[model samples]
Target: MNQLELLRKFTTIVADTSDIDSICKYKPEDATTNPSLILKAVNLHENQKFLNQAVEYAKKKGGSKQEQLLNASDKILVDLGVEILKYIPGYISSEVDARLSFNQDKCIVKAKKIVEMYENQGVSRKRVLIKLAATWECIKAAEELKKDNIFCNLTLLFSFAQARACAESKVFLISPFVGRIYDWYIAQNLMSNFPHNEDPGVISVKKIYNFYKKHNYKTIIMGASFRNVKQILLLSGCDRLTISPLLLKELESNNTVFNRKLIPPTTFIKPPVSLSEEEFRWEHNQDEMAVQKLSEGIRNFGKDQILLEKIISKLM
Candidate 1:
């Protein structure tokens, strides 16, 4: 078997794309989309219908031009999500508008709206994991949403503080960005050439996975934003991994033996104490890399979301 097949035996594979054709080709158990991926999907000729659906939904919903644009933008995400869900048996992570990442109430409201749009199209909320920034407010928003049976995937997680908070909040999953973390270190003069298993991103996810397992946290640790196939291979036994189609294609062609590098801790490890919001902010701020990356990730997501809205605006 190719590495992808071998790895699937131990880990759940999630496709990280909004292009339904690629999702169909990879046949990932679940799929995830962000503003950037959704923007890319909007450019796909085949996904044009979803854009039209968004416009129509926005028309019927009826609002001011800006509000209508916002509605249409969100509609595109759910419209695409509903389409992606038809192929995957598990959840489809459609992100809440990243612009609302810092506002807990707004994030919660938008998340519910996204789920409502999905339900309107005959999809259940159970299969949709709303993606949000791992900001304190966003995590709290997720905490509340979970009570309403809306599962969340906390994205842009870089520090242990974010992971710990999400786990304590009983979120459905946390996507620790492997490649972005590695990129931050590289910018700080860390060497790019290293053994795959020893990569810092791999090490970060492994640490989180082991800690979560040792303490028995139910929140799934999915390694995301991989830089290469090796990074994905190193995280072989993680709960789930959302990989891009390019890397997925690479793994499918290679015959490298997949090894289970990360495993749940067997020897008892001490569980770290939970963090209060103030404490969480303090701890997260101390990690310079995490602070910079979290901000950068949010800005990038917000920027891409704007670009997506611009596309929708043209159609309007």
Candidate 2:
């Protein structure tokens, strides 16, 4: 079997794209999209119809200019998510605006709005995972959402603090970004000494995975943002892996055998040390790479979100 097929034996493969064709082609168990991916999709010829429909719907709502723009952006994201959902059998993650990363109340409201939009279009809440940045407030928001039967996928997670808090909150899933972690280390000239298995990004996910499994935490770890096939191959037994189309194609064509690199340990480790809000903040503050990348990821996503609104406004 090709590596993709082999990897499936031990892990759930999720596509990380907004392109309908790619999602259909790879047939991932679940799919994820962010503002950046949706922004790219809206500009594509084949996806223009969806974009136009959202804009038209927003226009008819007859709100203030800013409100209309925000409405259109949300509608476009859900419309794209709705389309991707038709092609996959499992969940499709729809992210809240990254701008709301710091406010628990706003994050909760937006997450509910996205879920309400999906439900209004006849989709079940179980079919969606509201994606949020792993800020302490966002984690708190996710904890509350879980009570309402709204599952969440905490994205842009980088440090053990983020992972620990998400697990403690009982989030449905957490996407620890592997490529972004690798990028930070490479920028610091620290990856030259590491092999594929020892890659910093890979190591980050493995640590999170082991922590989750060793403690038997129900929160799922879905490794995301892979830079190469080796990263994906090395993390073969994660709960889930959200892979981009380019790497998915590479795995599909290569018939290399991939061993399961992560599993629940025979002896579970003691539960992770707990952290209060102050401690969480301090721990996150100490990780220079995590702090920088988390800030950068939110800023980058927020920028794309604004750009997406601009495109919708022009179309309107």
Candidate 3:
């Protein structure tokens, strides 16, 4: 069997894209879409209809350009997400505004609004997973959303504190970004000396996994943004891994034994000493790489979201 088939034995592979056509080709169990991916996908000629529909819908809404366009963009994203769900048995993740990455109340309101939009269109709440940034405020917002039976997928996670907070909040799932972590090491020129099995990203996820597994936290762990098939294979036995279709094809083309590496036994080391809010703040403040990267990721996503909204306005 190809490596994809082998990995499927231990990990659920999810397509991390807004391109439903590509997803249909590879047949991932579930799919995930973010503002960046949605913006990228809607730019294609084949995907133009998705954007055109948003424009038409926004025009019909007849509101201020900013308001109508953002509303329509969100609607377009939801529509495509609903369509994606038709092929996969698992849930489809639709992210909220990355601008709300730091706003607790706003995040809660937007998350509920997205859920209601999906419900209004006949998509059951259970089939839709709301993706939010893994910030302290977002985790608190998730705590509220969870109370109402709404599930969440925390994204942009780069450290253990974010993951721990999500677990403490009882969120449904967490998408710790493996590729971004790799990018951090590359930027630091630490790649040559980077340890594969216990790389920073792997170590971060392992801590989160052990915390959940040891304390019996129900929040699922789904590693995202993988740079290579090696990272995917290293994270074997993770609840899920959201991989781009390119890497999925690579795994399928390679014939080899895909080892199950991320088991509970590997976490024999005790979870990192727990930290209070103040201590967490201090620790995060000390890790310039984590702090800078987290801020950069949020800012980049926010910028793309705004750009998408602007494009919608022009088309309308």
Top-scoring candidate (TM-score): 2
Cα lDDT, model 2, residue 200: 90
User: RMSD for each model, in Å, please?
Assistant: 1.6, 1.3, 2.4
lDDT, model 3: 0.83
| Weakest lDDT window of 10 consecutive positions for candidate 1 | 189-198
lDDT tens string, model 2, 108-180?
A: 9999999999999999999999999999999999999999999999999999999999998889999999999
Every candidate's lDDT: 0.90, 0.92, 0.83
The superposed Cα distance between candidate 2 and the true structure at residue 89, in angstroms, equals: 0.5
Tens digits of per-residue lDDT, candidate 3, 261-304, equal 87764334344455566766676677676787789988998999
Residue-wise C-alpha lDDT for candidate 1, range 186-218, written one tens digit per residue? 888765566544788888888889778988999
> What is the RMSD, in Å, between candidate 2 and the native fold over all Cα?
1.3
Report, for all candidates in order, the number of backbone clashes: 0, 0, 0
Per lDDT, the best of the predicted structures is 2
Per-model TM-score on C-alpha atoms: 0.96, 0.97, 0.92
Pairs clashing within candidate 1: none
The TM-score ranking, best first, is: 2, 1, 3
**Residue ranges of candidate 3 with Cα displaced over 4 Å:** 196-198, 265-276
